[model samples]
Target: MESVKLFGTWFSPYSRRVEMALKLKGVEYEYIEEDLKNKSPDLLKYNPVHKKVPLLIHNGKPISESLLILEYIDETWPGPAILPSDPYERSMARFWAKFLDEKCPPAMTRACMRTGEEQEKAYEEAIEVLTFLENELIGKKFFGGDTIGLVDITANLIAHWHRFFEEFSEIMQPPLITKEKFPNICEWVNDYTNCSFVQENLPEKDKLAQLYKARIQAAKAATQ
Candidate 1:
């Protein structure tokens, strides 16, 4: 077996996505924590295009982009599949993942940087995205249906970050997503968090809250 190594930052949800997938599939690999602001030469060389963490290096080959690396990991390791087996279902899963990577961070960024009109607009947009997710869970336990697959992992990590955004973006008026408001997703979060691998790995929520609060304040100060 070739050696597998992962470069990631603890706070990034993008990094967490790959972490969850690897654990779920029971892949053994070494993790290299990177200081993204002061990126290492190795990370820069491996992911020169993005210069981002969550780069997966298998044997002598390097794969960048979280979703692409995830698909590669799934392809390489054929146990406990992350994507759907059916072609149509797989397309839907990819669609949701793409939507998430494209849309989510900006919503959080907009909410953090401005207030009044801008902040409200950001909140509205964020809720629309969250609403799509909440409604998608009407009958299905997970995003790609009953089994926890790619889409579920992609979106739930955002919902996790929303916990931080709530405090960081005090102006945020998030739509119904709590245990009382959206019971299925609430239970889904609990289920995912309770899974031994997720429980053992992933960032601690309390620390995330503090980091987000400070980071939001920094963004606010920078823009002002």
Candidate 2:
């Protein structure tokens, strides 16, 4: 077995996605936490292109980007398949992953970090994105079906981190994913978080709250 090392941070949703993929695949790896404010030499050397966390170093070779790393992990380890075998389904999974990656962060950032009209616009956009996901989640316990797979891994941000941000950030509006409004998403969140692997690797809520609080403060400071 080749040695695997993961460079990541505790509160990063991208890093957590990679961590969940590794844990679900039952891959044992050495986890090195990176300080985004002061990145380490190894992280810089390995992922010079993006210099981002969640870089997977396998047998001394580095893989960057969380989504690509998840795909690589699924391919490298056959123990538990994260992606569907069917070609069309696989494509759909990839499509949604890409959609969320491109659209989610900005909308969520707008909703949580900005205020007044900027926040209202972001809130609406964020709701649209979540609405699309809520529709996709209808009649499915997990985005990848019964078991948590590639789509679920990618969607983990919606299930966990997004909820946490809404909860902790005073700038964010009221909860958008309540059971009455988005039953499927709420159910999926419960199922995803209840999974033993997810429970074990999920970032502590209190720590994440503190981190996000500092971020909100920093963003406010930048404008004033």
Candidate 3:
């Protein structure tokens, strides 16, 4: 049997996505939890440059970056397909995943954490970015059409984490995502989070909310 191990923190969306992919592939591996405050030696050694969690060690070779790790898992294992088979569709999947990772999180964070003008600017940018995503799901059940795929997996942040951030920030800021503004996305969130496999891998919402609440408080304190 091949040696497979994953180093990740429980509350990280990136880490959780990787775990979801591994479980989807039915790949049994060791999971090592990392404390972000104090670095782990093995994590540092394997991912010297980033020294980040969600690092995959397969047969002793390390793969960093959650998306790359997901692709690796799909290609290496025989199970449900993560990306599309067609070249164009696969490229589009990758495109949207990149867009989400690059565009959404920073804007969402600023929208929730910043105040006044900065928050307004971030909110507009986030809406624009999310509009693009909403249009992408026009007639589809998932980013992968009917089943979970690369884009769907990568969107765990938006579907899961963003909701909690909105709940915790409602007093300080308006919600970035809502049924009124993004119905398609709202439905997608319902579908994605309801999946039994996805649920099993998700961090508990209450715990995640507490973490985000602390982070939001910290960010506000820094700005003040």
RMSD of each: 2.0, 1.4, 1.1
List model 1 lDDT by residue over 1-224, tens digit each: 77999999888888888888888889999999999779999999988898887899999699988889889888999678899889998898999898877886677567555578987887677667666766777887677676778876776555577667666666555543567656776877876666676666668888988998888788768877
Tell me how far candidate 1 lies from the true structure as C-alpha RMSD in angstroms: 2.0
Better of 1 and 3 by lDDT: 3
Where does candidate 1 stray beyond 4 Å?
A: 174-176, 179-181
Report lDDT (CA) for all predictions: 0.78, 0.87, 0.91
Kindly provide the TM-score of model 3 when superposed on the true structure, using C-alpha atoms: 0.97
Give a tens-digit lDDT track for model 3, residues 196-219.
989999998788889988877776
Which candidate has the top score in lDDT? 3
The TM-scores of all predictions, comma-separated, are 0.91, 0.95, 0.97
Ranked candidates, highest lDDT first: 3, 2, 1
Query: In model 1, what are the clashing residue pairs, if there are any?
Result: none
Q: Where does the lowest 10-residue lDDT sum fall in candidate 3?
A: 166-175
Candidate 2, pairs of clashing residues? none
How do these models rank on TM-score, best leading? 3, 2, 1
